[model samples]
Target chain A: MSTEVEIKSFIVRNFAPDVPPDQLEPDLNLLDSGVVDSLGLLRLIAWVGERFDIAVEEADISPDNFRSVDAIAAFVADARRNSEVAR
Target chain B: MRWNDDQQALHDAITELGDLLSENRAERDAAAVFPRANWDRVRATGLLGLPFPDRWGGLDQDLLTTMYVLEGLGHSCRDSGLSFSVSTHMVSVGVPLLRFGSAALKERYLPKVCDGSAIGAHAITEPDNGSDIMGMRTTAVRDGDEYVLTGGKTFVSNAPVADLFVVYARTGKAGSPNAITAFLVERDTPGLSVGTPIGKMGLRTSPFSEVSLDGCRVPATNRIGGEGAGFLVLDHVMKWEILCSFIINVGEMQHRLERCVEYATTREQFGQPIGSYQSVSNRIVDMKIAVETSRKWLYDTADKLQRGENVTTDIAIAKLTASEGNVSSALAAVQIFGGYGYTTEYGIEQGLRDAVGGTIYSGTSDVQRQRIARMLGI
Candidate 1:
């Protein structure tokens, strides 16, 4: 599965069960839409770290990074790239 | 993580100070008074700045090293309340400010926090909203260069003696993840008054009270993080709070276990040492298991956290295990000590009383379970 697809699936399954994966907009503001609360954000971050093999550091925990599916995927890709470059 | 010579030296330094810190602890606990003299001594040790940058007058130790020393503090200090206050002062304001504060803010306040000249506390829980941060009603409305804060916070650890507070108040709509904002409010800020220290079951020596912020105006620069970033700031702080605070509990449990073992073997009963019996020996064994388990969970979680892995579930489980284990270990120690434990002289009852707060503070055991369940997608 693609990064966006997997993220959408995880968010739908955990946070918005009523919303279908295909229907959940990639640009939907998860923070404002109340699709993800404070605890939900934590769950999302943890899932992202485990699923994407990215170590989400303290600096990367901004709301901007996790605001939408596309943003999260971008963050994951960027973090992976950075980790590889450092290695 | 094995500490090198320098880390061992720091840990040993604090361990040696325990004798002085614990002096008159029973009397202080009985009176429920903050030990000013001991607080001064703790300040001198620079333990408050264990995990902070050395540029800010801190010891510049890493998280694991800081926790390792804190565990030593718990093991050596008989006054659990004082140990609690020490941890609270560090994690409450210093942790957040170090992580999220601006460079100017760090330059101004980090020194005070590191030197322990200005004690720190954070106000998150309200009178009505205990564990529900999203339900917080304290609002901070932007007004020109200042944000006007009007709300009340309860159970603010170190409030009575605190010089600064990281107050979380609503900046947006309620129940929204981005609603709350964290502000660095000085204790002397107008309209901010701390209530008289409230009495509690345990951790009595660590003074906590209600903090009222009515139309208190704080400069925009005082905000710790970006507007609506209070939840994230708090999330980071809570992680440190659980690890730093509970590691002390781990230390306390280790001490309690040793005491129980010593008492069981030496204290004569029924014509032989009680430790020889399965019932008594079994309880001691369980206490031992609880100590090792709590230690393992705490350090393992810290290691994972240091590596920047997501620890939402790991932290909850660590908190639950350490907290619940502390409570059970204290109870078993009291039982093993028999009548001596029941009495106030040996401080066994006080240990049990102090242990109960572990289950409630930071996050309650129930809250931790809920967090873990949520992480499990339940």
Candidate 2:
């Protein structure tokens, strides 16, 4: 699976376990749909950082990236590819 | 009595210190310092013994007073670990001795505890026992003039620096829940050893560790009550411990809620503050509801406890509501603050970690549900 699909799967499994794979669109709003809360978001951040081997900084954890699964995946991809530059 | 003039003074004093403490929390948390100065500052404020007897230099206050002062401390103080340590000291150690200690034990320990000359801890959770108190493996064999204790207690709060500990061990019957006995074991006694503090995910500032008693001998007079009374003593004190923890979290909920509101009103997005969006605004409103309801429940529980009313159900309900609601409030606060909330610089991240431990300590949320279910005859 693509990195985006993998990240999406992880988020869905944790925050929206019942979410069907077909419905796991890239741009689906996780927070808005009540899939996760703040603590869940923290856990997600740690998971993304560990899996992608990126240093997701405090400033990077915003609605811009985490508002939707697509944004989060894209942000993670960018951070992973340019992990050194982001840090 | 409710928080009278003296209690108000104590509350105000701690709140002032809290303001200073919260500002310095990031540094203290990083360093893992025990916050001795802040603790002494609280001692000077005379709130250290708010719930103890007046004769022992305590405030002789009720649970309401204790809750108010502790709440104010939780709001003003930045170090939740330190506040937790103090709460554990008062509820788990001081209260137990006050309620069950022999007059001599009280005269010797209560004054020292009230004066902050000594820190006290309760050691009960063994490596083999977490939720199952009956699974404790510590044994205390009665020798000629003393009980020889042999076993290790894990997750002991304040074990490192405590001068006195209310240690529990099997004294009457093995594997029997009612066969345990509580003893006041002084530090430096032969065979009493404290392990290095356990490095934990949060509450790092409050030092915790294991205490092992290998042939640790203590006079028979140090026992809290008759043989096999330890479980009963723990039962009486755990309710208070649970309640005190809820009160502290209530303060944290208020603190986080206020910070989220302040951040929402300031930070702009798409030509308007992010909080202007219904999603953000509604979450903040939910937080307010949670905070208010949790506080009201805590207050009612405290009042009932102060009035000597049966508060088993009330205490359980309050802990469940406050802990779950505090998590909600912290989550909303972080969301409202966006990226800043997730960073260590903003302290919101730390608050979340500190708050997560609440769901585990005192008693886990799962255990609270079971207690409530059992209470309801489910």
lDDT of each: 0.91, 0.77
How many collisions per candidate?
Answer: 0, 3
- For residues B1-378, what per-residue lDDT tens digits would candidate 2 score against the true structure? 345687788788788877756657888888777888877877887777888888999988777778888888888777888888888878767877887788998998898888777888899888878766766889888988899999999999888778888998987545443457889999889999999988887777888899999999999999886666676577657777877867888888888888777878888999898788999999989988988888898889777655544555677688888888877788778888878888989878788777777787766788777766644534
**Model 2, A40: alpha-carbon shift in Å?**
36
TM-score of chain B of each: 0.99, 0.95
lDDT of 1 at B259: 87
Each candidate's TM vs. the true structure? 0.96, 0.78
Q: Best by TM-score, which number?
A: 1
How much lDDT does candidate 2 score? 0.77
Fill in the DockQ of model 2.
0.01
Residue A40 Cα positional deviation in candidate 1, in Å, after optimal superposition: 1.2
* lDDT per residue as tens, model 1, B193-311: 99999999999999999999999999999999899888888989999999999999999999888888888889888899999989999998999999899899999999988988878
Q: Pairs clashing in candidate 1?
A: none
Most lDDT-accurate candidate: 1
What level of docking quality does candidate 1 show?
Answer: medium
